[model samples]
Target: MRDPNFSHKQMSAPDRLPTRGLPSNSVTPSGRNGVSSRGGEINERIADRIVRVQWDLTNLKDFWKVHSSPHRSERLAEYLNAELKVLEWMPFQAYDQNERVDYLLLKNFLRNQLSEVHRDAELDSKVLAFLGGFFPLRMANMIEARQRVDDLYHKKAAESLVECTKRIILVKELIVSEKETAEPIVALRATKNLEEFKGHWQEWYNFYDGYDPLFSYWISEPYPKLQKALQDLIDTIKKVCLGLETEDEDTIVGEPIGRSGILEALDTEVIPYTPEELISIAQKEYAWCETEMEKAGHALGFQHWRSALEHVKDLYVEPGKQPSLVRDLTREATAYIRKHDSATVPPVCAETIQTFMMSPKAQKMNPFFLGGDEIIVSYPTQTMSHEQKLMSLRGNNIHFARATVFHEMIPGHHLHMHYMARHRPYRQIFETPFCIEGWAFYWEMVLWDSPSWQKTPENRIGMLFWRMHRCARIIFSLKYHLGEMTAEECVELLIDMVGHERATAEGEVRRSVMGDYGPLYQAGYMLGGLQLYALRQEVVENGDWSEKEFHDTFLKANQLNIELFRALILGEELDKDYKSQWKFYEEIKRD
Candidate 1:
C-alpha cells in the first residue's frame, strides 16, 4: 500500500553558492540595524493592510475564548473565509514583488487555517463518537457565555452545572460497563477530550465563583460534584480503554493523519511538491550521500561506507570532557562560516552561545542534541548502565558534534534566533519549521560543500551521517503518516537503513511522530534544505546577489515560506492569482 514516487529534479553533483574569504573575528554586521542593512524597498501601504488583517485576527481570537464551542468555531471560520475573499478581490496587480509576496503568503495562511479547522473538527468528532454520541459540550457554551459577559442567571447556571455532573457520571458508568471500544487513538483522544471538557466547565464556574456572592452560593456545591465526576470518567476511560494506568514515556503512540491531512499541511508550508515527490527527492539525496560516503570510506582506508561509519562512531571524546569539546567545535564552525562568508555572524551570537548537558532520563527521548538559545547536549550520566553509556558516547561522538555544532550554535539555530529577533521580529507569528529547521539544514549542505568544514575523510563521513539521517527521517515519517509503515517499522528502517543504534533509532522515531509535532516535521530537514539549496541557485549562483548578500537579505525578510521568500528575492511579476509551483531542483545525469 506504499505510495508511488513522483518527479523532482535534483543535481547529480550540487554546486556551491559564491563567496569571498574573510577573517573569522572580522565578521561583523554592517549598518545600524544588524547585518548588511541595504535599505529595504518595502511597499508600505500593501504591507500595512496585511499586517492590519493579522491584528484583526489577533483581536478576534482574544474575543473568542471558548475555542471548542460550535458557535465560536463557525464564527471564526466565517471570519477567515471573508478575509480570504477580500484578499482574493483586493487589487494587487500593480503591487511590486514584495507586496504581492506578502499578499500571497497571507492568503495561503488563511486557507491553511480553514483546512486545519476541518481537520481539528474531524479529530474532535472522534472524541464524541467514542463516547457514543455524548461529549458534554454544554459547558463550552457556558464558557462562551461568560466570555461574552452575558447576563448571568445564578439559579439556571447552577442547574446546568448539576446536569453536566449527571452526564459525566453516566459516561463513566458506560465506559466501565462496555465490553468493547474504539481504537487506541480514539480512546486516547476521548480521555484527553474529557479532561478538556472538564477544564471548560471550570472556566465557566470560576468566572463568578468568588466575584459574585449569589453565583457562588448556587454553584459551590454542584461544581465540586461535577469536577469529581469528570476526574472519575477520565480515569475509568484510561484504565478500560488504553489498558494503562500511568503515562508510558517509552512506547511510541502517534495518530496517523492520512494523505489528505498530509497534503493540507504541506500546502500550508507552501511546498509545491507532493509527499510522493518529496520522498523521491529524499531517495535521490540518500543515494548521493551513500556514494559520497564510499568516497570518504576509501580515503579512510575502509572498503565500505558502513565500516567507515562504525570507525567514526568510535571517535568519541573521553568521559567528562564533552563540555570542552562542544566549546571548541562551536569556535571551529563560527570561524568556518565567516571564512567562507556563508552568513553574517553578529558578534553577540558568537560570544553568547551556551551549552547544557542532557540527563539520562531525557536522553531516552532525545539521544542526540537540541538547539535554540542553548544546545542541550545528550550523553551518558553517572547512573546509566555500561551499554547505555557507550551508546550515548558513540551517538555524540566528536566528529558528529563537529558536524552539527555550528547547526546548534552560530550560523545555525542560535544565529537564526538572534537575527529573527532583530529583523522583522513580529513575523514570528508566521514562522514555519521549514524556514527555521530548513535554514539550519541548508547550512549543513553549504558547509559540506565548503572545503574547510569537513577537512578530513572522517569529517565527510561525520557530516554524511547526519545527511543520511535526514533522508531516513523523510522516508520513515511520510510512510508512517500515510499508513504505509508502523512505528516499529520506522524504528527498524532507521537502524537498518541509516545505521542508527537500536536505542537511538527508537528515540528518534518517538521524537519524530510525537503529539507535539505535525506529521511533516521529520521530512522538513532535507526537504527544506533542498528548497533553499535550489533557491540559492536562482538567487546567488545565477543571479546578481553574492552569497553574502543573498544570505543577509533572507535573514532580514522574515519570510516564513521559502517559496514566498523566493518571490521577494527574485521580484518577479506577481498578481492576485499566483500559486506555488517552483520546481527548484533540476535533475542532471552524473558520469
Candidate 2:
C-alpha cells in the first residue's frame, strides 16, 4: 500500500544550481509588511484562490480517494500549472521577504504535488529554481556543500580500491579530530560527520555484503571491516556526547537512566526523573485517576467505575452518523474557551475546522485532527463486526473525546498552524515536534487548570488519563529505544497502568513504534508541555506578562526549538556557541 504521508516523486538526477548571480527578478523587497500595494493585491488574490481550491478538495468526504485517483491528479496538475503561470507574471521584487517566502513555498508545494501526479523533469527544474530563490544564502551554501560531498562519492565509485581507501582514511581523520574537542558544537559536528560516514559506508557494504561478481572483484574484506569500525565509532560518539549506552544499565542498577532523543533534539538535558521516579509519578496519577473514576461512578449511579466508563463509551453516535459525539464535544470546548477569552481562536480556523470520517485503513491508528483546521474522526465501518464497533467506540469515549478536542483544535494545532501560516513564514523551516506537539499539549495542561472546562470528576479523570498517557509515552518510548523494553511490554504497561483496553493499548503501541513518529515524538507531548509550562511560570506567573499576553506572544514567535523559544521569550541574547542548560523539568512537581 502506498504511504499516505508522502508524495510520489521519483528522483532522476540531482539539480545543483549555484546561488551566485541569480536573476535580480527573483529577489524580494526587504520589509515586514508583505508586498507593495499592487503586488499585495495580486498575491492576495492568488493566495485566496489557492486556499479556496485547497478547501474544496480537502472538504470532500473522501479526500484521499481524490488524492489517489489518476483523473484527480491530472486535474490538480492542470490547476496548479495555471496558477504557476499567473504567479510568473507577478514581479517577485515588488513583494516583501515574507510574501516572497510564502509565494515560493506555496509554489514549491503545488509543483511537488503536480510532480507526484505527473513526472516532469521540466517541472522539477522549475521547482529547484524556486527552492534556490527561496532559501537564504547560508542555507544555499549548505546545500551546495552537501551536493559536493555527493559528487565526491560518485567520483570515487569508478576509482581504484587504493584511492577509495585513502579517501576513507582522510574522512576518518577529520571525524576523529572533530570528536577530540569536548565543545558541544564540535561534538554536534562530529555526530553529523559520523552519520554521513555511516550512510556512505552502508551503501558500499551492501554491494559487497553478498558475492556480487561485478563488485566482488574490486571489493574485499576491508569493506566489512570498515563498516564495523564506522559503527563502533558512531556508537562511541553517541555514548560520550548523547549519554547513551549500548546496553541497559537499569537491571544492574536500581533505576533506568539515559539521555532521551526527544530531549536531545530539543537541546534540553535528560529529564531529572529516573525510571523509578517516573514510575512513582505514574503510580500517583494512576491512583488519583482511579479515585476520580470512583467518584464519577457514584455520581453516575453505576455499580463500578468500569461500568461508568463503559456507559460513557456507549454514548458515541452509531457507525454512519453525522455530528459525532466528538464533534459535539469540540463545539462545547470551543464555546467555553471563547466565553472565557482564554486564547483568541483565529476567525479562519474557527470557521474552517471541518470534521470528516477516517478511512478504514486509517482507523487502525487513533483518530487525529491534523494542524490545518481539519479533523479526521475514526469510526467503525459498515463492514466491521460488532466487536470491532464496540472496541472503536469504547476507545474514544465522551470524556476522552471532550479532553482531546481543545488539544487538536481552537487553541491547539489549528490556531498554531493559522498563526504560523502568516507570521514568520521563513522560520517555518525551523519547526520541531517539540514546539508543534508541545504547544498543543501545553493547551491541554492550560485547559485542565481552568475550572470552566474540566468541571466534572469524569472530565478530570479523562484529562488525567491523557496526561498520564503522555508520561507513559515518555517512559515506554525512551525505554524501548534504549533497549530496555519491548513493544509488547509497552502495550501491557498502557493497559495495566492507564486502564487502556487491550486492543486500544496494542494500537497505541503499534502507532508509536510502527508509524513515522520519531523516537522523541511520544516524549515530546509531556516534556514539551512541561517546558512551556516552566516558561510560563517564569514569564507569566511572575507578572512579567499576563497569561493571554504570554500565549499570544508565543504564537507570534512561530514554532521554534524549546531553548530558542525560551531565549526569545526571556529576551536573552544568543551566541553561536550557546547550548541548552535550562533544566525546565527539574522543578516540575509530577503529582
Models 1 onward score TM values of 0.84, 0.55
Tens-place lDDT per residue, model 1, 173-254, is 7778884466877777677767776776777777777889998888888888988887887788778877767555677767
What's the lDDT for residue 398 in model 1? 86
Q: lDDT at 315 for candidate 1?
A: 95
Flag clash pairs in model 2. none
Candidate lDDT scores, in order, read 0.75, 0.56
Residue 100 error, candidate 1, Å: 0.6
Position 488, candidate 2: lDDT: 72
Worst 10 residues of 1 by lDDT: 1-10
Worst 10 contiguous positions by lDDT, candidate 2:
248-257
RMSD of each: 9.6, 17.7
- In TM-score terms, candidate 1 sits at 0.84
